[model samples]
Target: MKNLKLKAARAAKDLSQQDLAAAVGVTRQTIGMIEAGNYNPSLQLCIAICKTLGMTLDQLFWEE
Candidate 1:
């Protein structure tokens, strides 16, 4: 498992975890877990997150 890049991007956009969770239709705890690398979301959830954040899945989850 790897760390999510969400925290940095969200901070850059001035979005709180709760704000992102609401945008992606998930719980704040879910976002927290994702950020903490404690949860792996389904493809649909991943897509939702990427879409809401104006990023690609690779940008958020993949490492070189």
Candidate 2:
């Protein structure tokens, strides 16, 4: 499924995919793939994203 929660959180923070990717030490394409549900990041990457976004794993990655 598409990660709308993650997308919303990124937008709420006023971050583009490139910005968030830089903060989390990944490429913009990686961020795009995550949002597009074409890639599943590692736990470490997931935690890095959460920390950068000021969100918990559940808030962004957990399926409803």
Candidate 3:
């Protein structure tokens, strides 16, 4: 499934995919793929992304 929550949270924080990826030490394409559900990030990567966005793992990566 698409990670719309991640996309929305990134948007709410005024972060482009590039910005978020830079903060999380990944490529912009990685961020895009995550949002598009084409990539399944590692736990460390997920934590990095959550930290950069000021969100918890559940808030960003959990499937409801």
Candidate 4:
């Protein structure tokens, strides 16, 4: 499934995929893949993304 919640949260923070990726030490394509559900990030990467987005793991990564 698509990670629309992550996309929306990123948008709400005015963060482009590049910006969020740089903040989390990944490539923009990595971020895109995550939102596209083509990649399952490592726990460390997930935590980094959550921190950069000011969100919890559940708020961003949970399927619900």
The numbered model that scores best in lDDT is 2
The better candidate by TM-score, 1 or 2, is: 2
Superposed Cα deviation of residue 46, candidate 1 (Å): 0.7
Model 4 residue 37 CA deviation (Å) reads: 0.4
How many angstroms is residue 51 displaced in model 3 relative to the true structure, after the best TM-score fit?
0.3
lDDT of 4 by residue, 1-64 (tens): 8999999999999999999999999999999999999999999999999999999999999985
Clashing pairs in 1: none
Off by over 4 Å in 2: none
Per-model TM-score on C-alpha atoms: 0.90, 0.98, 0.97, 0.97
Using alpha carbons, what is the TM-score of model 1?
0.90
RMSD of 4: 0.5
- Residues 1-64 of candidate 2: C-alpha lDDT, one tens digit per residue: 8999999999999999999999999999999999999999999999999999999999999997
Candidate 4 clashes between residue pairs 3 or more apart in a chain or in different chains:
none
| Model 1 lDDT tens row, 1-64 | 5454888888878999999999989999999999898998999999998888888989998877
Cα RMSD, each candidate:
1.3, 0.4, 0.5, 0.5
List candidate 4 segments past 4 Å from native: none
Better of 2 and 4 by lDDT: 2
Pick by lDDT: 1 or 4, better one: 4
Q: How many backbone clashes are present in model 1?
A: 0
